[model samples]
Target: MTRQSRAHLTDRGAPTSRPVSGPADHPVPATARFRTFRVAAFALIVLVIGGAAIGLVVTRLLGPGATDVAAIQVHASMGGFDPPALTVKAGQPVKIEFASMDSSMHTDGGGWHQFAIDALGINWKVGPLASEVFEFTAPATAGSYSWYCDICCGGKANPQMQGTLTVTG
Candidate 1:
């Protein structure tokens, strides 16, 4: 092809400026284009973060309602509840295992390892052994109940050896 023909051919399929281009290529300035991109990016980030937070909250809400309760075992002399608190079903058997280092209180013979679930109307006593099982329907209400070492025989004055029972129906 001739040089002129080649030049025409090259420009044929290309976008050409007017005899004199306008102020700029775009009606909206380049800065506006950049601002739009930044805004979109920020919106995407917010959506992602918000979705993650919502998912966490939903998972926690739909998770298991409650499970077996536990206690934090502490020496009678030291005086503190093992685990401190626990949760259990309203109509389920209860088990408390005590582990005490107060040889004087829990003599080899048999002292008192009493347990009280006042909410469930359960107040029973056991022995020096660190384990006992009580079969009774827990209180049919969901609330907090306090159980303490009634036998101040716990080597101290009202030792803070107390725990909470969270009963849920």
Candidate 2:
């Protein structure tokens, strides 16, 4: 309970004593200081590593995946789309050949354009005349599916560039 002073060597290599503030006014033991620092560092490392692992796992689980079927393509041209109606097997892949009939009259500088097909959880998107392919696993539960030009080229009128893929099981 008595106030004790801490002793240390000064820059001149001479012994010196300075007044200390805690328990008996003595400097804390080196072992206790090292133990506290070690514990804190270990905890920080564990937390950082744990967080990264969780993030990595979540990303893998939620990201997109490749469907079992093959790819299909369709063509879009000026005025309308070729093969306005398409038929595909129930559980296979169909490729659509996207060709531009008249580049001089099509929107987007009289050339091909790009758009996305965001339905049925399928990520099908490609550029004009670029031959993009999308795969439908199986008949999509036996129903009619419509694909349209997401691009705003139609203005106030219907783009007439849309098409339908009928899945037959």
Candidate 3:
């Protein structure tokens, strides 16, 4: 075969310069690029919205701010309040945040658990799966005062549901 013919026909008689298209030959148009960007932006917005929803749910489940006025958290269940003992300075401002861990009882009317310190004239109640805050001033007289839950489990009579509050001068 002549050199020119040999160059044009591979031993198999196939053309060397077959027509083919690459990415550069078919450039993406401005509108298509904009649509792609819009889709990506929409996906990002969805992700952010979903994340925020999850955050709100988690926050609700975990409970709200720890911030308070002389905040103290007391939990009450069938077994009664945990940390039955508390201490404070005489005449000091005090705040108790009460939460009922009891799921068995309904709290639509206040709650099943009541915290009362007769001497301090403080009485507060919270229902199942609920919380409440109480603010008071410690008794002026420095002494050990009794506190108790007056509800389902028992009152001041039930040792398990009763606690002490000590006021120091």
Best by TM-score: 3
**Model 3, residue 158: displacement in angstroms?**
1.4
Which residue segments of model 2 deviate by more than 4 Å?
Answer: 1-73, 102-110, 114-117, 122-129, 155-159
- Model 3, which residues run further than 4 Å from truth? 1-70, 104-111
Question: How does candidate 2 fare on TM-score?
Answer: 0.43
Model 2: per-residue lDDT, tens digit, 1-169?
A: 2222222322223335643434443344545667999999999999999999998667433322223234333456545555667776777655544544333334553545433344655444444334444444645456777666544356214557576767787
- Using TM-score as the measure, what is the rank order of every candidate, best first? 3, 2, 1
| Best model per lDDT | 3
Ordered from best to worst lDDT, the candidate numbers read: 3, 1, 2
- Clash pairs for candidate 1: 71-82, 71-83, 72-82, 72-83, 73-82, 98-130
| Candidate 1 residue-wise lDDT, 3-111, digit = tens | 4564454455445663323434333344666799999999999999999999866743332222334632322223455566778787676555444323334342244
- The CA lDDT of each predicted structure is 0.53, 0.52, 0.71
Task: Estimate, for each residue in 1-169, the C-alpha lDDT of model 3 and write its tens digit.
Answer: 4544544343334344744344342233435667999999999999999999998667544533444545798877666667788899999898888877655334422336888888778888876566788889888889998878867644567887788889999
lDDT of the structure predicted as candidate 1: 0.53
Where is the poorest 10-residue window by lDDT in model 1?
A: 60-69
Better of 1 and 2 by lDDT: 1
